[model samples]
Target: MSLSFASSPFSVVCSEVSFAWPDGTTVLDGLDAAFGTGRTGLIGVNGSGKSTLLALIAGELSPASGTVGVAGEIGYLPQNLPLGTARTVSDLLGISATRSALHAIERGEATEENFTAVGEDWDVEERARAELDRLGLDGLGLDRTVATLSGGEAVMVGLAAQLLARPDVLLLDEPTNNLDLDARRRLYEAVSSWPGVLIVVSHDRELLDLVDEIADLREGGVRSFGGNLSAYEELLAVEREAAERAVRVAGSDMRRQKRELEEAHVKLARRVRYGDKMYEQKREPKVIMQERKRQAQVSAGKHRLMHEDRLSDARERLSEAEEAVRADAEIRVRLPATEVPAGRTVLTVNGLPAQQPASLEELIVRGPERIALTGPNGSGKTTFLRSLLGEGPEGLQVKIGVEGVRYLPQRLDVLDDRLSVVDNVRAFAPSASVNTVRAGLARFLFRGRRAEQPAGTLSGGERFRAVLAALMLAEPAPQLLMLDEPTNNLDMASARRLSEALEAYQGALIVVSHDVPFLRTIGITRWLHLDRDTGLTEIEPM
Candidate 1:
């Protein structure tokens, strides 16, 4: 029998499903849940089983036990994307003769003769073009390679491809991670209008607030709360309080039972001795002996029950308290810095163009300042960064003062994949020995064997830390730090920690990010918005 959720109220139903990785790490245990047609937000800390849960729901992985039933077709946007570099935005949109051929095949219109004779006809090309146009990729040529596109453009292309599949459910993981403000807004609007069930995993607060329900995954289970992000947060607070109360009650009961059990044992011992002394002194021993035997049986039964109750209560209290504590703790993060003198001029730019072939006449950045580079996606944010780093046009006037500048590129292109963590750090700081490099990496949390591990095997957050470690170890330590989309793959805790470190740093900073809360926390004193239409960069107070 075929299983589909197309006509069902619940798009996904999972009953007592359990899953574990090959390495013996249990991800989900006896999980039961159902998702209806609405926007659902999945929230969890790093390695808290959020991604694994999503994969199971999307049918990418089968449950190790129980049943997972899908009621409809699903469109999944995985965290690790394998995009074809040679495919263009238009090509990714399926605007080609091949798309038409596929459509014809689906409609049973492509006969053997037609397939052989008119395979590359304009009808197919026109249909593909129309679809691409609907997705806002109208003028882009079909042959344009995807590699030339910006991060936001790449994401949009991927989203468009998934939307074209027209599935009844959509699963997206960190869809807006690298997008700028404008692109994020566009993507959000698109997802909001989607008719089917939407399950999104993201750290973006704005995106979470748009969803109808929030699913918090922790402690090997999932809990669902209705309403938007704020409402869910309120519900979480209430649940935490309730759990705390339960824990306290259990603890008190366990302590009381333990004391009673101890007291009962002492009383029973004293009674036995008193009864023995009375039996020795009395002539009517039969009645007294029978009473003593009955009394000893009652005491033994009472002690056994008390011991069992105490163990149960203690176990319950510990479990409840642990869950409550985990939920209540705030995100953890750390950032380190080196002392440096404030320089006069950090950067200067003249006639810099936005992404749409428009130009900004002049821009200037000074030292010991924090500037928030704000712009919509495809407004030349990353392009401007490249120009500042001298990778773009030669004619464009860009200059930096004598001060050292450390740049964290948006794409993490500076990392060496083949090198170990220690070697990568040493490469950046040639004067530093292996021990010094390892020590710096350790400060960033790469300890023990992890420091010797190859950079290729590290997670996204670890790689970012490795890069930061290398930057900090530089002899003169950069006086100005430029970071582009630094929080893309970071968990909530790591993002907060990095923010704290940046806030404590003495050097000048230029940051490009779409995370408003992060920007606010990191102390952005000035803001610059790049207008795509006017091709100009304007400064505004934060």
Candidate 2:
């Protein structure tokens, strides 16, 4: 089952691969490709077919046409993890002898002698522990229930479990979405040294730059380019410019043809009038008739050529240019703001504990201040947010001011899946009319009929925008905004837009995100580090 030791360098191959959903939506069309032993970043907008392609390559979904050939074992880490309430990390790993024995017995391949030989002296438990440690989950008890783990901790554990398989092809979907700076660095380091092929679906530009190539999924197909992130961006820019130039040229040519055709018709009309006058006078009759006929034929020929030949290419060029411009347009997000009293404390924590039975000490925040909460995964980023939100009460006395606070949970809990985007925004601010809600949603790029679509049908980025729209609609807008992993599913342009919006906000901002550059861009005035060693929180001016 371990394909890493195989002789083949190329781990995955796809030929004329095409896939469609049950509803007949074409997700991929004629995607012919081969990937070998190197890290390749997969970049695309939401619903651009990145996730679907990853699933197809991982054998989780079959292609509707052609074939997907896997030369080696594949390990896939799904975007959404399902960790049952009763399962512990150790239980999930199948490290215990009892579970291993059960698996063997179920296979009908284990005898009493083999079972006894394995016994209670299983190395799987130790190996699991070692892997967890390597993932920076050291000292965390294996028997600790998964339900109690924070979101970041759970993600790290899942990643550790997959990495332990040592697969020949590793397919990761937004692997660093919820991780902090240190954890992202660790992940990057791990992938950099991985011997086999890595196909990663991520919106992280820094992570994409680390890859050997970037595969852009767009318009139901994939385009592979051998370059880093910057190079790929430059190529896209150049292509867009060329498309624009073609469109301009086509427009000019169409205009010239129209003028020439009009001139030809005018000349033909004059000649016919002169011929009719000469014929009426019974002077030069045959010559006038022939001249009129020739003029009519010439005008007709010019009109036919203009309609039949020149127009089609012109229209095609215009369409291509429009598509290119659309592709280049950055995602737009507009965050509403309100005036708030300056210099008020929004959150204050003294002796806070991020982990169960452990303590985090001295975390504090003031009003109208931008702060970045960062640390390694499982080092209490989300836990710290929860503690501030009054979700956890252990070794800390947390105090939140009476000011209006808005918290955007990491998983987009603000979104109502059953309602339309407009309805969701209206729910947050009922006094605002439906038209007002629609306008606000439009600011976030959900325009016209798109605002009427169900929230469940929207892609990840759209869903995030919907949630943000709801937040913006709230009256007496929140003076304190706490966002936990806000940029997880957002594309690069959207992330930058969100950062810009945050920077422009007049209210206090407390952001917990894995994107280091984003955090830096938002102008974090302070830094909060949650230390896992001593279960303490430290804050310093940036």
Candidate number achieving the greatest TM-score relative to the actual structure: 2
Against the hidden reference, what TM-scores do the models get?
0.72, 0.80
lDDT of 1 by residue, 63-98 (tens): 899788876688888765566786665566655545
Model 2 — TM-score against the truth?
A: 0.80
lDDT for every model?
0.73, 0.75
Q: What is the Å distance of residue 532 in model 1 from its true position?
A: 5.3
Residue pairs in collision within model 2: 352-360, 353-360
Candidate 2, residues 130-204: lDDT per residue as tens digits? 877887778878889988776767777777877767887899988887776666777788878778889998988
lDDT of 1 at 490: 70
Worst 10 residues of 1 by lDDT: 327-336
